[model samples]
Target: MRGPRRLRLPRTRAGWRRLTQAVAAGCVLALLPPTWLYVTTGGRAGTVAGAPRTDVAVVFGAGLWDGEPSPYLAHRLDAAAALYRAGRIEVVLVTGDNSREDYDEPDAMRTYLVRHGVPDARIVSDYAGFDTWDSCVRAKEVFGVDRAVLISQGFHIRRAVALCRAAGVASYGVGVADRHDVTWYYGAVRELFAAGKAALDVTFEPDPRFLGPKEPGVRRALADAGRRPAAPLPRDAGR
Candidate 1:
């Protein structure tokens, strides 16, 4: 016997309209992560504040020219340089990518800081800060820095803060005027998306490019890594 005819659902104009709206809503829902990050990060956080501060201020990597820092990188360096002069941090950890044949962001960052009056002794360049996550992890394990002042554009500082915290670095936020002068109006839109990605990087386990030998002892690898070299980063970094 033939099975009862299956009834077809209506595909009328209104039904199509409802379906389209539902899909649109789902797309919007998919954007929740970025939206949450954007909504939460406002203005800047505390500036070189009191006691909780420590030995290092990790200046994340930006652009480089052969071995020179990009203009954008210069701004971050200056901000970090200023903090160093103020005695907020005892040392500066410059971390950046050196993946290519000659592009070295960390060394460039260190040189820029030195020219700005920060001494080389006070700077340790990590030639493998593949990203904020790499820098945060290396800072805690390789550099032995338990706390740090994270300098970056205002919109990026919050995400950087979260990433550092997850990596076990007691990260604090310090804003450097964004490379873009003026508010740039709706700039928050892009920043929001960036924050979402930063949020995930916390749990994301990625290896440092040049993690050196002499990693921690068999008994206390946890404590030993805290003294590891700083990790490096890339330019136009999503952080």
Candidate 2:
């Protein structure tokens, strides 16, 4: 290796010191917005410590690969299913991204719920709920959802509730307890940015991709036999 290669690198102690400073700075930067929002909102910006319950438990998608639900996604659904069994919520709305040609998150969520003993009829899938705001908006316009319990980790539900308030939804959140050893460092960093973006989603009514073309609100079931022309029942029974 020649004669120490002309000593181009920093001394070992100095290099370690610089690396430590960089990591510290990065963590501080990541914590700012959630911290700020909490301070600014009078400490209401993080997860609700013991959130009041609600009607619908909306299960937001965490991730998927090749048509299978990730463990994080499964956690959200498990919480929702528990809520339903405990009578804390009436329905579960599985919202997720389905942008790719072969992936479908909502159905994956649905299958999970059904296999776990949640009745098929109690679950609803929103094919276009690609994000939190979209799910809340579609809840009102498409599914007639006036109240709900947003499901996610403790750090995420705060911004979610704030978004719900902006959309005129009466909502609370159910925080899924996570194992401490699970590695979430990157997601923790990303969530600080997500919080700020959520603050925007609160005030901004950005158009959803499936809004104009998709059917949102419930279609009445057969119109109680022969009332509206769009009703699909036989034409002669009670009329």
Candidate 3:
């Protein structure tokens, strides 16, 4: 059999110009998703002190360290606790991975929040939040979280806010400040690619990794606080 032909570059000037145009177009196309995230989430992200008052606060899991919340995850939980203490949020929906028997992010997050002075009863756990998209979807559908203040690091808050809004949960994002460490840089770079997946999640509106029956955890938590779940608000209401 004949050997495969080697790849060739454009030979003529016109061909080179066309190739350059193609490359430029590809760069723009690749960046469009991240740009969309920033544009759509403009003015929607802020510190915990400025977070909009909402019935629920959704904290996306960062990671666990020795079955405890990692520093990054702890920061997120701390922001949520502050929101609760400031009376900006009522219920806290801690969503994270719990796929394995020993790695339980939601419970770890719940513990961290409780230790931070957030009442145990005000914390609801979503053990199936396998990713940002899953957490946002489950928050709206499974937990009936119509409106929320989403808590995550600054690098991630825009995507979180965009995904939650796409999932029909009116949201404001509380981007917890953190030192610009290696992990923070990694997370910032990672969001560029994650923005593409977020766009697909919005476009396709796929079912979460686990979409179980609607749970009354949020409602019960609200009741425990002597409050009724607020009426669902327009996605752009607080923006």
Candidate 4:
């Protein structure tokens, strides 16, 4: 038998140029979603002091450390707590992954918030927030949150706001510092793909991982937080 035929490759200069152009075009297309998310939500995320008061402050989970919240997570909780104390948000919904018994993110988040002076009655724990999309979907479907203040790091808040809004919770965001460390940089890099995924999620509108009958969590939490008025915030609130 003849030796395996040499695989024919694009040998011409024009063919190589076309291949390069195609790759460049693909990269540009991939970047569109991240660009769109940043532009659309840039104005909506800011410091906690600038965030508008909403019906609930949805604190998305960062990682945990030794059965406690990591510093990044603690920062998010701090912002939510400040929002609570300022009377800007009526309730705090701690949403995180709790798939494993030993690594319970939501429970750890709730413990941190409670220890920081947030009343347990005003804290609603969402144990199924496996991802940003899951948290956004469950917040709307299970928790009955129509509007919310999202809390996360600066690099992530725009995507959070976009995903939550697409999930039908009219939402703003409070972005904490990015920390400028290895973890923060890794998260920022990951957000490029995450933003693209979010765009597709918004387009397809997939159901959440878990959906149950609407619980009274949102209403009860708000009532327990003293039924803070949902008045319109100043235009500069989202500065």
Supply candidate 2's per-residue lDDT for 126. 84
lDDT of 4 by residue, 2-95 (tens): 9989977689999999989999999999899999998877566789878886778899999999999999999999988888888787789999
**What are the C-alpha RMSDs, in order, of all predicted structures?**
9.6, 10.4, 2.9, 3.5
Note the Cα lDDT for every prediction shown: 0.66, 0.66, 0.89, 0.86
Question: What residue pairs clash in candidate 3, if any at all?
Answer: none
Candidate 3 lDDT by residue in tens digits, 80-167: 8888888777899999999999999999998888888999999999999999999988988899987888899999999999999888
Candidate 4 regions with alpha-carbon error over 4 angstroms: 1-11, 233-239
Error in Å for residue 7 of model 1: 28
What overall lDDT, based on C-alpha atoms, would model 1 receive against the true structure? 0.66
Q: On a 0 to 1 TM-score scale, where does candidate 2 land against the true structure? A: 0.70
Give the Å error, residue 39, model 4: 2.7
List residue ranges in candidate 2 displaced over 4 A: 1-32, 36-53, 181-183, 213-239
Which residue runs of candidate 3 sit more than 4 Å off their true CA positions?
A: 1-12, 228-239
Error of 1 at 233 (Å): 24
Q: What is the lDDT of residue 86 in candidate 3?
A: 83
Q: With candidate 2 superimposed using the best TM-score fit, by how many Å does residue 3's alpha carbon deviate from the native?
A: 24
Candidate order (TM-score): 3, 4, 1, 2
Candidate 1 deviant stretches above 4 angstroms: 1-27, 35-44, 47-53, 179-193, 208-210, 214-239
